[model samples]
Target: MPISEEHIGRTYPATAPYEVGRAKISEFAAALGDADNPAYSGTDPVAPPTFAVVLASAAWGAMFDDPELGLSLSRTVHVDQRFAWTRPLRAGDEVTATLTIEKVRARGTTAIIGIAVALSTTDGEALCTASSTLMHTSEEDAA
Candidate 1:
């Protein structure tokens, strides 16, 4: 089934707060081949710019798992992703993410979905806004 136009402005539930820890920051930076950066690995660690994706991806998952959305992760291709941050994430910051579907367009057997994810501190301070475009190919042609 194709993504429905009626779902364009839908917003999903906010994710549980995720606490940023020094070990997790170090692991993420290392996975990005940035372990040598003092800012990400030092005693007082500041997460790199792209670290917000960790939280945003979780928000995206909620949308993907929504039975009403009719989305199939196996048939989707993430086309683009961008992030805007108010400040660098640092170890000890507890944050939660909420996702909103901004737009949806269909072409032939493919649907383009726009998603916006907002990350905020547990206390409600805005942290980052992450946006993505995904191309979900209809399962009928998955072969």
Candidate 2:
């Protein structure tokens, strides 16, 4: 089934707060092979720019779990990602992510979905906007 265009402009509730910790920052940096970077270590360390994905992914769960959307994780391919940040994410910050469906387009048996996740502090400070484009192939198209 094709992703419905009606999903566009829908906004899901904000996710539970995720606390940023120094150890997690270091761990993520190491996974990126950037452990040696001073910014990822010591007191007052900031997370890598792309670390917002950690929170954004959790927010996307709302969309994926919506039965009415009929989205299949097995058939989805993440094609693009972009982020706009007001400031770098730092350790000790409590963050929440809210996902919004921005656009949906169809071509043949495939659908391209655009989603934006807004990351904010528990206190309501804007952090970043993470946008992603995903392509979902119908069962027949995938075969």
Candidate 3:
């Protein structure tokens, strides 16, 4: 079955609080092979504006793996991404991100799903918001 507009408005709770730590920041930066990025390095650590990808990667699975939405994980492609930052993430902050399905649109061979994910501290202080557009291609489009 193809993705339907009915999947819109689905919202999922925070997967888990990802603690921002100096070591984790270094590891993330190192994984990307960008150790020279000042914000994500050093003892007094701070992270890049888009460091929220760490949280997003973990939280995104809920939607794709949702059987009700009938979204095929294999056929989906990340079409676009934008990050809006309220502050730079620093060590010792525990952050939680909730993924919300904001919109779903479909035409002949493609479905565009938009999500607004909120990344905030346990006390509700927002660190950043990531908005993504996922394009799930139909079998025809894939072929």
RMSD to the true structure for each prediction, in A, is 1.3, 1.2, 2.1
Ranking by TM-score: 2, 1, 3
- lDDT of candidate 3 over 44-105, digit per residue (tens): 78876667888876788888788776677789888899999888889888999899988888
Candidate 2 pairs with clashing backbones: none
| lDDT agreement with native, every candidate | 0.89, 0.93, 0.83
Off by over 4 Å in 3: 139-143
What TM-score would you give candidate 1 relative to the actual structure?
Answer: 0.93
Give per-residue CA lDDT, model 1, range 48-79, as digits (tens). 88889899999988888888767888988989
On lDDT, the candidate that comes out on top is: 2
List the candidate 2 regions with Cα displacement exceeding 4 Å: none
| Tens-digit per-residue lDDT, 26-131, candidate 2 | 9999999999999999879999999999999999899988877778889999999999999999999999999999999977888999999999999999999999
TM-score of each: 0.93, 0.95, 0.86
Q: What lDDT score goes with residue 86 in model 1?
A: 90
Better of 1 and 2 by TM-score: 2
